[model samples]
Target: MTDLLMNPTVARLTSRSLLGRKRTLLLSLLPLALLSLCTLARILGSLDDDIAGQLQGSLSADLLSTFGFAIMMPLLGLIAGTGSIGPEIDEGSIVYLLAKPLNRYTIVVTKLLVAIGVVTAFGALPVLAAGVILTGELGEIAVAFAIGAFAAGVGYAAVFLLLAVITRNAVVVGLIYALIWESLVGGLVPGAQTLSIQQWATAIIEKTLGYEAQLLFVESAVDFSTGLLALVGVTLVATAYAGRRLQTIRLHDES
Candidate 1:
């Protein structure tokens, strides 16, 4: 287990999968769009609080909630989470690792760490940079939103990793949850908003910025406590479940 945890080979594999051509391209898209929009917004006029408010409130909020959480987070999670283990499982290459003396749980934990790191870099960091670009450090709103993005990234990675362990269609299911449930239903249905990852994340931002801030840049359907609880609970449960699943996983024949 120690060797597996310390293994450079695992890190190499994780990095390769994460930085692969397709995943890298997809991951770059949203951040590029964000930067471009910020540049365009700046070019149009001087950065005013009113302009910042509209940018941060309407545009930034929409991008973070709709595109960041609903699209980018899940897509990045799907790539990082499933990319960490799915290909190995699909091609029966996992037997190489499983046959070693390492404990299965160690492998799972290592991969989960890699996935979390990847999600943080590709998902959360960009959100932070984008938030700053949109609103500056005004009232620390950018910092607040960044914290929410980081928290959401960790939770999203855990959930998607567990989904990878449970099903081959982890990406599809993740997309459905992120896009359909979080985006479509969570918007129109009042009850569904309480269950949304996007809302939970935004609630963190709302709390950090206060009620007046909530009235402006951030909006959340659920209260702060519920959102924090759900975020922490989902992250812990999904990680634990993924570890347990790894312990019992059976590798398929390559031939």
Candidate 2:
């Protein structure tokens, strides 16, 4: 299994899919937009203490939660996760690999690793950079949010990878969950926050930054323990399930 996971062909395929022309362009856009926004804000000379506080307290927070985690991370994960398999499935090209003697689970794990890497690069790194730009590492907020983004990206990639295996509309489902469930319901309904990845991730950031900061960002329905457990559990389960699903996956006919 380890050998299969390390297969050069698998790595090659993963890299090609992740770095393909269209997807690469799409992935680059988010980080570029974030940096541009931060630069614009800086150039506008709106760095009054009050404004800086608001930028850190509200604007940066919203960007991390709404744009970074909710919009960008999930979208990137969907593209990476599903793109790892969806195109092969769609074009019936997966049969070439499946017919070989490689272990199915190995393939899944390799693809998951690639997806996780892609999400971290395109999603987490920008969040960290943006946080730094927003507050110059005040209270280690940048590091804290970056760590939260890392954890969230891992879970997001795993969940979306499973969704890709189980359904054709994985991207749509991921978008709905990221946008409607995490953003809308998680905000409007207090209880829904526990079930939200955004809240769980925010809880991590809160804990890392101390109680006051935690209280500021995380209105999670679940306690820290619950949120951590759910995040870890869901990621592991999704990866395992995706592996099992791949083992039995049937290739569709091109004809």
Which residue pairs come into collision in candidate 1?
none
- Measured on C-alpha atoms, candidate 1 has an lDDT of 0.74
The digit string of per-residue lDDT tens for model 1 on 2-92 reads 6655466776777788788997887778667766776676444254656655764666565556666666776677678878888877777
lDDT of 2 at 102: 85
Please give each candidate's TM-score: 0.86, 0.89
Where in model 1 is the C-alpha error above 4 Å? Answer: 1-9, 47-53, 56-59, 253-255
Residue 220 error for model 1, in Å? 1.9
Give the per-residue lDDT of model 2 (tens digit) for 81-118: 88888777766788888888988777877888888888
Error of 1 at 252 (Å): 2.5
Model 2, 39: alpha-carbon shift in Å?
Answer: 2.5
